[model samples]
Every structure is written in structure tokens, then in C-alpha cells.
Target chain A: MKARLIIVVIVLALMMVVMLVPIPYLSKPRTHHITLDSQRYEYDPGRLEVHQGDTVIIDFTASDVVHGFYLEGYGIETRVEPGLTKRIEFVADKPGKFRFRCSVTCGSMHPFMIGELVVGPNTTLYRAAATMLIGIAGTLIYLWSFKGEQHE
Target chain B: MTKIDLLTAAPWLKPILRSRLFQPVLMLATLAFFVMVILTGLFGTPAGNRNFGIVFVWIVWWALLMIIMVPFMGRIWCTMCPIPAPGEWLQRRGIVKRTSGKLSTLRWRFPKRFRNMWLQNIGFLGVAIFSAIILTHPDVTAFVLLGFILTGIVLSILYENRVFCRYVCPVGGFIGLYSMMAPLEVRVKDPSVCVTHTPKDCIIGNEQGYGCPWMLYPGGMQRNTYCGMCMECVKTCTQNNIVINVRSIGSDLTVAKERRLDEAYKAFIMLGCAILYSAVLLGPWGWMKDWASMESVANWLIYAAGFLFINLVVLPGAFALTTGLTRRLSKQTLSTRELFTHYAYVLVPLGLAAWIAFSFGFALVNGSYALVVLSDPFGFGWDLFGTRDTAWQPVGTTLIPFLQTGILTAGLLFAINTAYKIAAQYSQTHRQAFIATLPVTGFMTMVTFILLGLYLG
Candidate 1:
């Protein structure tokens, strides 16, 4: 029982350390020119993936109706009209998934019209997944230690 | 492992629970909110963000239900639910005081075949398929709520005692299923006392209260699955045998004998819905939303067919295969079907966590809308509370991913524990149980990975 408790404590401490540690990224940052198309309730490129120091310049166009591009965590908002182009540029400094939603109510499902921008390295996802693996391993170890103790 | 009777722990609580006015007062309070929701839904602007009905029901009430009430208090919402209030009152013919010697109803017996959660499973699917529309349109929200109340009233007039909630209501089914995880349960202090007493006042009506309006006998009750916690049994128990005890959370999941396939299917459906809802609603896929919201009839038909298929067939088939592996690995003589039913209980905590994680994503982001809608309920520029013009601000955007990660991880740990405990019930040796738990652990781990991927990136 004492050993099992110690194992549990060690697993939890490992998870916390993994969660708090920052990962080193080796990819060189570059400027990327991307085109974003907007329709009634969707963005054409629904996801944008860029390195942490990359400069992202987007030429956003609305094909069907008027739409607003409000990117979370970046504080960038632009309005695109049909038959016109709206340019938005920002530095990919924040290294996490940020949602870009339609600020204007376009239709019934307008509130849910969303797109995602992922800035690498996505340390959060990696850490979470690693923590989950550690948790399961710890649990199995703890349960395996309970052999012959059930009848005690 | 330890039972603390809340009635004994807090003596002041017993009288409040036993009062005839308690349930009614709660019902009336929520009824007032219900009426406001309906009225605002009918008369309010088409913008769901500015409407009281949409913000309150989907954001505020949903957060409360998923995050707090269901986890901690069990079916306490059922105790105060206003949907069945009018029907029950009409049957009793009075509100504050008990006036009916017999309930005014036709007393038609609900068919025995329809007693399980099959109807609720189907009904929830029926509503869920149209959630994109029902969630956004205030008029549609109003109509659906109206439909629920009307069905409740019609059922109440035709039968006796909360048949609507027990068998037919869509929301009530999952609440009852997940209520198993709640720490609080209303049960008998001593079954021998109930047996020795002749009147069985908990089952039959006495002057103090109507008999268990959920139509369950308090003495024979073992799980929190169908007990609505209306406190009627508390009021009517002649020997003071009924007690609301605070027991260990998820204790009912270990009761292997009461496991049934219908409930197993419910767990599958809930987990499947949570996954699909996250992908469709929160995922960066507009075409999926277009199909779900019924931009075209053909697209919606395709989406609905796929939705039903994944929920009813694909998810369950996968889990059944996992359970089959568990049975074979453990060398258990128990049938695969039995193992499947018993092991589905493991999904309750993870399913709930998936829902909470999903809710935190939107409800907190959209929660500020509740305040705006409260002041200007109809969105006609009526500032009743003088705070109608509050701007839209998404709270805790930086903290949400961490919260989601923690919740999903905790849920996975709980699910693994539950899986081991359930496996132990079928195994003679601890090694056998550990072997049996591996396959299910792998399945749950995969599910957690999927949810984490969606939330994180």
C-alpha cells in the first residue's frame, strides 16, 4: 500500500512537470500568404496552422454574403463583403489553438460559424496527451499491485 | 462506504423537505422563469444571442445542469422541474395543500414493454437531430418547450404519477442515468421497518402527502436510476424509515444485477452525441454545420442518417467488440452481452466530462449574453434591468484549454477505476480482473485522445 501511494504521487508529479515545461521548437519562421474564402456560414480554409514566429498575411474574401473575421487571442477583426477583398495580417506569437468566428449574425447557425488558427508548437496538446498516458499507466500499476488483496 | 443521512445531519432540512409547500414553491419559482422564456422566445428578436430563451436555456441552465446540479445534487432538477408541474397540479386539483382523495385521472396503465428508457433514447435522438435549429431559433425553442409541456399534460391526464418523467421525457432519461454518479440518494433507512409497517404509506396516499409520485416504492428501491427525489416518500413514510443519505459517488454503478441493455444503449448514445456535438458545433467545419442546420433537405437527410447510424450502430458495435475482448481475455463464463451492459457504466463519468468540457467551451464564451438578454428579454430595446447594452466578451479564453485538459484527464482516470471495479465483479482473481480491464481502458483512452485532440488543436 505504501509503495502504491508513492507510485501514485510520482505519476502525478510527473504529469504536473510535463504540463508546466515548455517545449523547444526548431522550425524556422517564414511569411505565409494565404487566401480565406467565406460563404453563408463557413470559412473555406477552416483551419490555419503556422509556426510560432511566422508572419501570416491573409487576403479574405466573402463569396456569398457579408461576414466578419474576429480572431481570438490575436485581437484581429476584419469585415469582408462579396465582390471585395479584405486583407488581415498578424504575427503568430501565441502558441495554441485560437478560434476565429463570424462577428456578424449571418444566419440561423451564425453563432457557430467558426474557424481555428493553430500556432506551433502546440505544447498543450502534447503535454495533455502525455499526461493522459502517464495517468493510465499509473492506474494500471496501482491496480496490478492489488493482486490477492481483494480477498483480504 | 459511509452513509450520512442528510435528514439526521441537518435536522432543519427535514421539515423543509417534508413541507407540502416545498416542491410547489420550487416549481412555481422555475415556472416563472419558464414562462418568461416562452414569452421572450415568442416575442423576442431572431438573434439568439440577444434572446432570453436561447441564452438562458442553452447557456445558463445548461452550464448549471451539466457542471453542477447533475454531478453534485443528482435529480434535484427533477424535483423542481416546471414542465410536469401543471399536469401534476391538475391531477391533484390543488397546489399548496393535498385535496385529492384520489388523483383525477383516467389511470391508464402504461404498457409494460414501454417502461424502459427506449422511448427517451429515441426521443432525445429525435430532438438532437434538429438541435442546430432548435438551439438557435427562439420560435422553434418556444414550440419545442411547448410541445414537451403539452405532452406532459396529456400523459398526466391519461395516467397517474409522473409517467411522463419516468418513461417518456427525453431529458429525464439521461438525468436518471447519470444521477447514479451523484453522492446523494433518497432511500429507506431500514427495509425491515418498511416490511413490518402495514400501511406502506410511501406507496399509498396518506393525508400528509401524495404517494411516491414517481410511482416507485421506496422500500424496494436500490439505485438512483428512476427515483425522482420529489420528497413525497419523505413526507408520507409512516415509520420515519425513508432517509436521504449521502453515500459514495458512483456506488450504483457497481450494482451489477440491475444492469440492462436499454441503459447500456443510453450510455452509448450520450457518449456518441457528446463526440458528434463537439465536432459539429465546436469543430472548424462549416459544411458540417450547414448540413446539420438543414441548409438543404438532402444534406440534412444525409447528416441525420449518419448521426443515427454512428450513435445507434457504430459506437455501440465498437464498444461491444471491446467488451467481447474483455470477456475472452478474462476467461469469464459470463455472456458477452452481460459484460457489455455492466461495463457501459464506466462511460458515465467520461461522458459527463466530455459534456462539461464541451459546455465550458461555449457556455463560458457565450455566458455574458445571459446578462444582456436578462435586461432586454425580448430584444425590443426594453432595458428592464438597465444593463441591456453590455458588450459581448468571451471570458477565460486563455484558461479554457487547461480546464478542458484537466477535466478530460480526470474523467479518464475515473472511468479506468470504474472499469476495473466492474471487471472485478466478474473475475475470481485480481489478475483476471486487471486483464479484463485492459481492453476497455484502451477504448476509453482512445476516446479521451479524440476529445483532447478536438479541444486542444
Candidate 2:
């Protein structure tokens, strides 16, 4: 019984740690360079992670047809054609995960053409993770408690 | 199997339900919208968010189906589905009421081997594999819709009584699975009444209405998995025994004998698909999106293999392991196969919640685009409603994470509760039951965590 209790605590602690670990965002804004390559329907390095107060410079190039890179929440959207590079510069003032998708109709699977820009101090992700852990914990506690109360 | 009759409470709904014109009329109206969506698909703007077909079908109608219809009303959409309407009308040889003459086609029996959910499962996977294309491109969407209608018509001509819907429609597969949780059901008022009542008009049909289109015997129907809610059973019952009931959600989940491997696999596939969809469509996984969208034939093949393997083998394998553990831990005398199948039902609520949660990510993000598309359906620069140029604004963008967390939490709770209840079935001792539930709960919790990482990470 003692071993089981210890195991349970360890499991809860590990889960809580995964769900509640804080991200350290740089206080000062720094300029970062990112190269994004687009093929039939995807962007290379599909995820770009940065601190909240960073300046992002992205060199977007298309390997095939004309593709539009429309970033949600950042108000930065551009069209990059084959053999031509579209350079965009924007400040990462936000702290969340935002999708940057192909706005142009490239082909059959054009609408699903998407990428992500994740800025740090991403609290919602942590909140959501914590909520899920809590959900599991809450339900288990209730079921166990209910069973105990019934004395069956 | 226990149900409370809605007719006993409302009483007046019987007339509306009995009227043969009601269902077809609703079908006709939806048909207009359906045709309009198809037309827009063929001649609309190339941009998906701006086009009516993609917006309305994927975002609007999809949202309604996941968040409302399937959750609240069992097989309600099947009652007035436009895909099977024209063929069904032609088969009956009339639009509104039952016609006197024979149906206008060759009526052959659908093969017995293909009658199971296996075909529907395959059909759903076939469409799901190309979902990035089907859910996006207007031409593809239009063609898919047209294909379904034509298939329905051809099946109606070749076979008898909605073989297309009962055994073929891809959408019906998931809807049928989740519709088990819906509060609304059409069942016999008393099974005794139908058992003794010989020469059943509900099965053979009378002048009042046609035989069951969904190919279900209303008498022994304990679950809403197959019943299409067409009211044909209600209309044709000479003894007036068929009654629609407003009962508790998921009352069918506990039905033991009605469970099947096909339906259980469907639960796994749906849950897996929901997780994968969240990752590819809503997650930060671009390479996965590329592979899923068939960026190349090779990449697509790999993605398809992984997708199938995960859905068919991985999820089920993991679940079977968990169920096996539960059985072992409980010291139960029941067969492991029975326990596995029954435990799979626990994922139904979780799957439904996952789909709804995953939907909110895109549905809310792109939901506002529906308004713009509605105003300019054809996208020929026509602003019929003057809202054509509505800017791309994601509704509830800030609230999505919270909403998702809350929804996921609710789903987990339901699943855990279901797990405990299922464990209770095999275990006589409360201690044994609690021991049985522990591993499954852990597995479910881990599943929720994966969803969290996908949606919230």
C-alpha cells in the first residue's frame, strides 16, 4: 500500500511538471532569421519557435508553384512563387501558437497546406495540459471516493 | 434498452411525424441548399475559406453535425439526407406520399456479405484518406457529393431499400457510432407488442408508409446504431407500437449483445482519426500535413500507411492490451474478447468529444468565413447579400484553448465513468472493480494528454 501511494505521487508529480513547466522568455528583443521552403503543400521546419519579444525575419521560397503564406494572428501574409523568394520581417509580440497556411489554391490538397509559428510564454498550452491532468485526477478521485462511500 | 416515450409527453408530435410529406419536404429544402453548395463548388472561387462549398460543408454543416445534431438527435440527419433522396423518391415512384405503383427500377437484394459496417468503415476510410482534398478543393467536393448521389441512385436501381445509406454512406459510419449517445431514439413502445403481433406491417410495409429504409427491424431494435429515424416504421406499424423516445444520452452503450467488432473498430478508428486530424489539421505539424495532403505520391503512401496502421492496428492493439489488463486485474471469469468489445464503447464518448473539440479549432477559426461565402456562393464577384467581402476573422480565437480544455475534461470524465461502469460488469467485488479500472483510467488519461499536446502544445 505504501509503495502504491508513493508510485501514485510520483506519477502525479511527473504529470504536473509536464503540464506546469514555465518558459523563459528573453526580456530584450533579438532579431532572428528563418528560412522557409515550400514544396507541393508543406513548409520546411513547419514550426518556428521564438520568444515573445523577438523580431523574426523569414525568407520564404517556393520550390514549385505559387504559394501564399498567410500567418494568422501576426497580420503577415505574402505570396511566394517558384524560384523567387519573398522576404518578410515582423515582430513576435504575441505569445501563443499560430498557424501560417497556404492561402493560394496550389492543388487538390491546397487548403490543408499549413505551418505554425509558436511564440514563447505560451501559457494556454500549459493551462490546457494542466486541465487534462486535473480531468483525469478529478474523475479517478470521484470514482474512488464514491466507491469508498458506498462501502460495497 | 429502457426508454421513455416522447409521444407520451408531447403527444402532438405523432401527427407531424406520421405525415409522409414532412420528411420529403425537409429533404427538398436541404436538397436546394445541397445543390447550391454543389453549384458553388463547381463555379466558386478557388480559395476554400472564400468558397461556399468548402465553408458551408466543412465548417458550418460539419459544426452543426458534430456539436449539435449527432449529439442531441440520433440519426436525425438521415431522416432528410439529400444524398439518398432522389433515388429513394424514384424507388418509391413519388416525392411526398407513398405511391400506389411499383418502384421505377430493378430491385435486387444487396449481397449478404457486404451488409455489415465493414463496407461503411472502408468507405469512410477511403474518403478520409483524401480528406485534405475532399474537404478543400471545390471540384473535388462537388464531385464527391455528385458521386454519393449517383451511387445512391444506382444502388436504388440495382438493390432494394437504401443499400447506399445502410451499407455504403461514409458519413453514416461515424454518425451511427456516435448516435448511440444521442438522446432521441425510435424504438417499439413495448417489445412484447411487436413480438406477438404477426404479419408485421413495419417490416413488410403498408399503404401508410414504406418498409424500414435503413434495413432494421424496429421490433428488436435496442440501439440507435442502424435506425435512420425515417419514421417509416412509425407510419407503417398497424398496432401503433413504434414510439420515438427522449431518453438519456448513451443509454445504448450498456447494450451487451448488440456490440460487434466492426463497431468497436469504428470507435478506435474514429478516436485515432480525431487525434491525427488534430495533429495534421490543427497541430503545428507541417510535414505531416504535407504527407497527408499527398504532397507527393510517395509521401502520401507513407502517410496513408501510417494513418491506416495507427487507426486499425495501433489504437485497437493498445486498447485490447488495456482491456486485457483490466480483465486480468479484476480476476474476472468472462471472456477477454467480450470485455475488449464492451470496453471499446468507453471510447465513444471520448471520440465524440475529441471530434467536437478538434472541430472547434478549425470550425471556430474559419467559422466566420461562412458568412462571406454565403453572400457570394458562386464567388463570381457577386455580392448578393452585401457581406461578400467580410474580412477573415477567426471567431472565439482567444477562447478556443479554454473551450477545448473544458470539452476535453468533460469527455475524460465521461470516459472514466464509463470505464468504471464497464469494469463493474465483470467484477463482483468493489476492490476488484477498482483494481480493474485503474489501468484503463491511466490509458484514457494518457490519451487525453496526447490530445492536450496536439491541441494545446
Candidate 3:
């Protein structure tokens, strides 16, 4: 019983310590500028040009039902419900133009909920293409590993 | 035999469709596919926001289990379990290539003194902490399914028996703990037959196959803790000694002497989990968002610790303190542990009812997603069923939600009544005639109604 108690206490203490320990770098803030009632978004400057050290905040909202603001490559995602404003922040440490899209299952035209983030020096279009290529490669690899030998 | 009797008698009537191994593999593959789907649906396309299919699967299946299945069949979910199948397959593969006698025996004996209901309690905590995120998010559905698949495979290969199902599976733990209040049970027809039999086929499998995977001795089985209703024991018993019996609701609680410390501990854990699940899932907090946003390792660690604190520290601690307080008040020199073990039995029904109430709304709303399976089994289009295109609107206007809330309230009252009865029996006090059970019961009843309203409206 004593040993068990000691173990529990130690485990809890370690957890507390880890939880309190802060990450070294400040989280970069990415702005997702959006309009709620209008169901539209205007990324201030509609396109962003940022260096690797900078952060961007996507300050956004939805006009109708809840719309999720999600960027695939950088792993930044959050919900933008109607009548509510949401800001998703992320670092542009990686020099790449990532595609941002709405995640929430919206209406019929939800399939066209696509947007692009331009990163680096006037190479945003190039970065977007590269990111798309990487996504394609990742998909192919996953299919190769998981799919049955019949495909081979 | 009558229809009811025939159904009861042939409990193992259905042939195990997929090998225990297949379920886990399929679950893993399905989870992986869903993760990819979430990523693509969220990131790859413009109209990706409508993938409620995965979320529907996670919430509806579990809701069905808690509401209808666990109360009726007693942990049969652990039998057709998809989580541990991969691990068992790995174990089988390893064992097949080796000489049967050459391998070192791998059975580890559970220490008699150390055995406690901590695991069950911990399991409930685990489920409660994650319930908010798991119930709400479509993306996290993949993760939860993957978690089960990983757990199933890992435990099956490592342990001699289904340790994941018995000791670790959060859902299994909850079902086993609260299922004490359930009326139906599988038990031996004759104790004498069990006593006379030299080799217990129920515990150790005969030429037929592996016996009770949870290691329950059926002759002494009184409660729903260890039985997975695998029916291997039923099949192996030479005398045909086992039968599924229907009895009074709280029959298991009346037999106090047979209660184990682990079981008593599990009851408290189930209660704590019930409260915590209600707070996190139904309560208006940003708990769901935090759970999703937290890094995976950190999220899981927090959940594990929270589980330990609530199940192991808080609930048991409270129950023990209450028993101690009662003893002092009554001037009775009863052992605190003994008193606690007896009183804790009442909380089982409360936990069961709370689980039912909490899950009822989600099941009703999200169960419509199952139809999507017919249209797109392999993610291909097949509109012939017409079920695939249908989006679930709640069955009736406000009527269904109101009816559900009433049913939930009734269930909670039943739980409190069961608790009060046990308390009266143990304390031997004048049934405090005016002592209102209504305040707490009423609060929970209101909470259930409000949650249903929010979910539906």
C-alpha cells in the first residue's frame, strides 16, 4: 500500500511538472479574417507574404451554419460558427504556400471551399503546387502500404 | 421450449462470424481510412465539411451499447470486440510457428492482496474525460476506433487472456461495473454438478477450445464483473449445467458476503464516471475543444491522470469518508471498508441509469448515419438504397426529445430508489420518511432534459 501510494504521488508530480513546463518558442499567430452574416472572408491583403520567422492569424467567421477553418499542410484548424468570431493562429516557419479550406460539412457548394496561403518571396504559387504534390505522394504511399496485394 | 426460453437457451446460437482476429484488423483499417478521409475532406476539397459519417459511427455504436445492449446481454460487446483482434492474431501467428511445448509458460498470477477495482474505476475515468470530444468531433472518431484496435491487439498478444476486455477496455469496464443492476445473468443450474466435476471445463477449456476468456468460475459467478458472455463455458460444460436466468433487479446487491474489494471499488468508480461524463459531455464547457486541440501525448496523459484521480482517489475517497461519518453518527463500531463495500453496491444502478440517460439523446440523433454504410461501403456511390442520401432530422418535433427526457428521469429515479433500499438495509435505521431523495434526483432529471433539449433543439 505504501509503495503504491508513493508511485501514484510520483506519477502525479511528474505530470504536474510536465504540464507546467512551457514550450520554448512563442506560437505564431495566423489571422483568418472572415465575415459571419455575409458568409464571406477577406484575408487582409487577401494574400499574405511572410518570412519563415513570422506568424499569421486567420481571424474568421461564418455567414450561415458553423464553418471550420482548416489548413492541411500546417495543421491549423478551428471552427467558425455563425454569429461567432474565431481566430486560428499558426507559424509560417516552413517556407511553403499551404492550402486552407473549410472543414465543417456545410451546404452543396461546400466542395468549393478552397483558399490558398502564399508564403516565401513571391513564390506562393510554386509553394502551393509543391504542397499539393507532397499530399499526392503521401496518399499514394498510404494506399501502397494498406491496400491488398491484388493491387500490386 | 417457448420462444423466450429457446432464445435464452441458445445464447451461443450464432456462429462467431469473423474470427476474433479479423475484427481488430478490419477496425484498424477502417480507422486509418477514416483518418485519411477526415484529412482529405477537411483539407483537400472545397465542399469537405459534411462528413458526419465517422462521427455518427463512433457516437451511435457506443450509445447503442450503453442504452440497449450492455443492460441486456452483459458484456457481450467484449466478445465481438474489434479492438483486441489484431493482438490476438499476432499471438496466434507467433504460437503457430513455435513448438507448443518449447515456449515458456506466459501466465502471470494476479497478486491476491494487490487485486482491487482500481482498473475498473480508472477505465470509467478514461471514458468520461474523453466523452465530450469523442461524442462531438467527426475527426476524433478515427482516433477512438484506432485506440480500440491498438489496445485489443497489444493486450491479446501480451496477456494469456483478454486482459484488455477484462481490465483495460473503458467501455467493457463501465458495462461490467454497472451491469450488476441488470436482471439477466448466466449461471450454473446445479452447484452440485460443478462441485462433483473434477476438471472444471468452464475455467479451463477442454478439447473444444479456450474457456472463459475473462477467467470467471461460472459456479461462483454472482455479478456481471468478469463474464463476457463468450458462451465457451456454456458449450464446454458436460452436464449442460449453465443457464441464463432472469431475476429481481438488485439480486446481486443483496448478497454482500460474496462481494470482492475490487468490485466494491468498481461501483464507486462507475458512479464518479457517470457524474464526470455528464459534466463533460452534457455540461456547457469548452472541454470538447480543449481535448481536440491538446497535443496527442499530452491529451492522453491528462486523461489517464484525471481518470486515476476521479476513480481511484475522489469517488473511493468520498465513499470511504461517508461510511466513516455514518459509523461515527450511529455509534456503530463497523469496519469502514466493510460498510463501504456494502453501501457502494447501491451506486451501481445509479451509474447504469445515468449512462443510459446521457447516451440516449446522441443515439437517437446520430444513429441515422448507419444508413450511409449501405450506399458507400467501399466509399463508392450506390444510390439504389436511397438511405445513403438521407440526412437525419430528429424523428418528431419536440415530442421525441420530451419523451426521451421523461424516460431518462424515470431511469434515474429507479437508480436512486435502488440506492435508498440498500442504504436502509445496511443502516437498519427508521426509513427517514421525509428525507427527500427528490433534490438530487430532480437536479439530474432537469440536467437530462436540458441536455436533450440542447442536442435536439
Best by lDDT: 1
The backbone clash count of each candidate, in order, is 0, 0, 31
Could you give candidate 1's per-residue lDDT for residues B1-457 as a string of tens digits? Answer: 8999999999999999999999999999999999988998898898888899998998999899998988888899999999999999999999889885899999999999999999999999999999999999998999999999999999999999899999999999999999998999999998989888889888887999998888888998899999999999888887888899999988888888889999999998999999999999998898899899998999999999999999999988999999999988899778989888999999998898898899999987778888899899998998988789887677887889999999999888988999999988888899889999999999999998989889896
Tens digits of per-residue lDDT, candidate 3, A11-120, equal: 44543444233334444544444332213221222235565556666567676677665554566667766777786676676544443545555643232244545555
Candidates sorted by TM-score, best first: 1, 2, 3
Question: In order of the candidates, what TM-score does chain B achieve?
Answer: 0.99, 0.96, 0.73
What TM-score against the true fold does each predicted structure earn? 0.97, 0.87, 0.60
Which portions of model 2 miss their true places by more than 4 Å?
A: A1-40, A52-95, A102-110, A146-152, B1-5, B43-47, B101-107, B238-240
Scoring each candidate complex against the real one, what DockQ results? 0.70, 0.36, 0.03
Deviation from truth (RMSD, Å), model 2? 4.8
User: What is candidate 1's lDDT per residue for A31-113, written digit by digit as tens?
Assistant: 98999998867898999999899999999999888998988777788788899999999889879899888876677777788
- Give the candidate number with the greatest TM-score: 1
Ranking by DockQ: 1, 2, 3
Interface RMSD of each: 1.6, 3.0, 25.9
Against the correct fold, how does model 3 do in TM-score?
Answer: 0.60
- Provide C-alpha RMSD values for all models, in order: 1.5, 4.8, 20.1
